[model samples]
Target chain A: MKLYDRVRVINDGYEGYGIKKGDEGHILNAEIRYGTFCFYREDPETLADDASASVRIEDLELVEDGGATDEDILEELPRHNPEWGCKVIDGFIYNLKGERLNEYAYDYHHRRIK
Target chain B: MKNLEALYGKVTDYLKYGDGWVRRENISPKDIDVCNGEATDDSDTRTCALCVALNRTVFKNDNKPDYTHPYCKCEQIPTAPPEPTLDFPMRKITDYLFVKKRGLMYSMGYSEEDAKEVYQMIATNAKEQFKQGKYFLNALDNHGQKVNILLAFPGKREKEGHVYWIKTGWTVYPNGKLHQNTPFGGWAK
Candidate 1:
């Protein structure tokens, strides 16, 4: 399945791998490792920040086909609030526009990369 | 803790259907975290992955052990018949699928007749044949010819008793050539 295809958790696999049964979301990224496809759920905060729910390919069943227009994907992605600050190349600090080093630390930390 | 107990129960139940079912085994504390049920690999819940893998490979001598935790509540569950299986709302294969499966089987080098027999073999052993990946499986034809089959488990509808939705089929040879229209999904496959 390509990106933006909707997926639903079909079973309670192990610890649910972060997504519970009936949890539905668009697939942001998918990669096959160790003989299985690991899916990342959709959520975007800032550049380099990935917000996603991890699920096994086995536990997920394709829901909607991914024929999303570029506009659709861009809309689904978490947009950068102009006030949040610029994207940081370094891993630690983000949000320089505000007085704090990381006004959105919680959001950045919660980003599910890969 | 309840989930862990449930997981243990599920494993033992599947064990009952195993062939030449040997003695049941328990995972040790060292292999898995006794305190938190955390996998060393940083996965949130690999114990469940182990459970599925065990259900698939338990009959083999190489089946690995899995521990829910050191204080695993399931360690004391009785091992014997009166086996309790988790009730899943299963789905039955519709007759319409037979027509679709025919083409899937022939794509894997099965003669029309051979495809019919292989189709039944796959349907009957659905659980064993189903693997979580890019929707493909390895099976033998009537002549024991190794073949690959592509099956999809669409999330749109849950086929209660049904495992893989065998909508696509293919075949594989000993040399590892996948003879299906779809490409294998993995590193450089």
Candidate 2:
């Protein structure tokens, strides 16, 4: 229902997208691109560890209260490396050092930029 | 070629189903040099990055690919998966991104008319940086390995001698193909 909410797949419609009933994931984005919610789903059994996908809102059931928020992510970002500072400018997220921090390129861990 | 044959068999076994198996759809002879599997130079092995990723995924349950003995030495089996060749799907750029992020592209030294050129530049640079292991690992979602890289281009302030560093996102698939996820993630330092 909200970003960072832990949810479980409750619909079989997402089978083709590699999701199935009872699969758990963390919501990443909500209802922007044509009402589809994007979430990061991981299945250790099949080695789908880094999997993410988007589906209709009706397919998910919220399982937890909170996961990560904007402030939470930003607070965690600097701990990955002391030199990094995060900020958002004009709808795009970046580090104080000027590194882009959006999309799959998001180095909240500061692993790639340094 | 015995080592290659053995490696191939191992991959096939791991991906095998009762009556079906993973398809080696995009693999080509040119992508891997089997005849020179015994080459002294690592180019032949390096070229097998895709195959290495494939097998690496096969061994994911154990967290590492275990290629053994004669095949290990004779085949130059790398202890780790080599940097895979990147797959930049052009339509993702020309059609979707160019239309969606026209402003961001322009800010990064790319114009509406420079879509193809810009895409080519990103693809080329991404491949080079990836080979150098400059990419950062992001979360794995969508059944793919999410990674990011910082790429530099002639900046919007080019006349002032500034280089624009952009963060690009990609999904590295199990088959060793990488598809660009975000053409732009904002300007990098």
Candidate 3:
């Protein structure tokens, strides 16, 4: 997904985040962390991107606005982090095992809890 | 006086200094949230004062290396609009938390795919660990060697009701240079 590309949520989105199934949100930015997409609630009042989410490319059907194609979208998607690409779910970092790591405690990234 | 004592309950929270020693903090849960993400602002679940001030002075501010509660895995903002909890049905660990960077994975002797597999193993089986100055992990490494792991859980949040969410984890080894790059190996050991 590219910035400002109109997209629709295929599956029910995260309710806690106020995302619902079939909710049409604008792709505020892609290349979020890993291969995830960041979008915003389609509202003028909303300034920042409403949500940063990882959607299966299949789960999001592209909204045609004279924007990029399937290949373009896929190419823009990063396989992994070019930088220290940690997943920040609701602003906390976790390892792949669903356990929590205290990386963001301080120092932009906190020193590891010894 | 007795009521005040009950209100400001003496809770000795663990504090870390630069020298790598833990200092005992005698604090009382303040009437307000006091920065630690207690679920209710009410008295029952509140954390104490010294802990709150230390949280801001050390963890929230620029004070070189940071200090943290020994048990708080996730650093949820201790303020209004508590961070959202895991929406999905709570499980042992979140399967979605992946390795941070591709090059880091390569450096750690793992292909992107292999690193993902390793992460999957860590999150699926970590229990609530509360050991100070130690890795609270018990898992097998890729080669089946038993290892200690650290996972970040959702810190104090209202959605989580002042409890922790076992959201993510990472694996570590003692002699990390002997094996993969364990992020917490140097300090955690």
- lDDT by residue (A29-97, candidate 1, tens digit) is 222222223243322221111113345455666776655433332322223122232222232222323
**Deviation (Å) of A57 in candidate 3:** 2.6
lDDT of 2 by residue, B1-189 (tens): 977876686666555432222223222233222311111223544334334333322112212223333423222122333345654555446644555445556655566677787778888888777655577766543223456778987755343366777777765543344555566644565
**Residues A60-108, model 3: lDDT tens digits:** 5556342433333332333322222223344443433344444553222
Span of ten consecutive residues with least summed lDDT in model 1 chain B: B84-93
Error of 1 at B79 (Å): 3.6
TM-score of 1: 0.23
How much native contact recovery, as a fraction, does model 1 achieve?
Answer: 0.00
**In DockQ, how does model 3 score against the reference complex?**
0.03
Q: Model 3 chain A: which ten-residue window has the lowest total lDDT?
A: A78-87
- Interface RMSD of predicted model 3: 17.1
Write the number of the candidate with greater DockQ, choosing between 1 and 3: 1
lDDT tens per residue, model 2, A1-114? 444466788887777656778888655432222234566665443212244567655566768755344444343331233233233234333543456544433222333333
> Highest TM-score: which candidate?
2
Error of 1 at B170 (Å): 19
Q: Could you tell me how far off, in angstroms, the CA of residue A4 lies in candidate 1 after the best superposition?
A: 13
What does candidate 2 score on TM? 0.40
Better of 1 and 3 by TM-score: 3
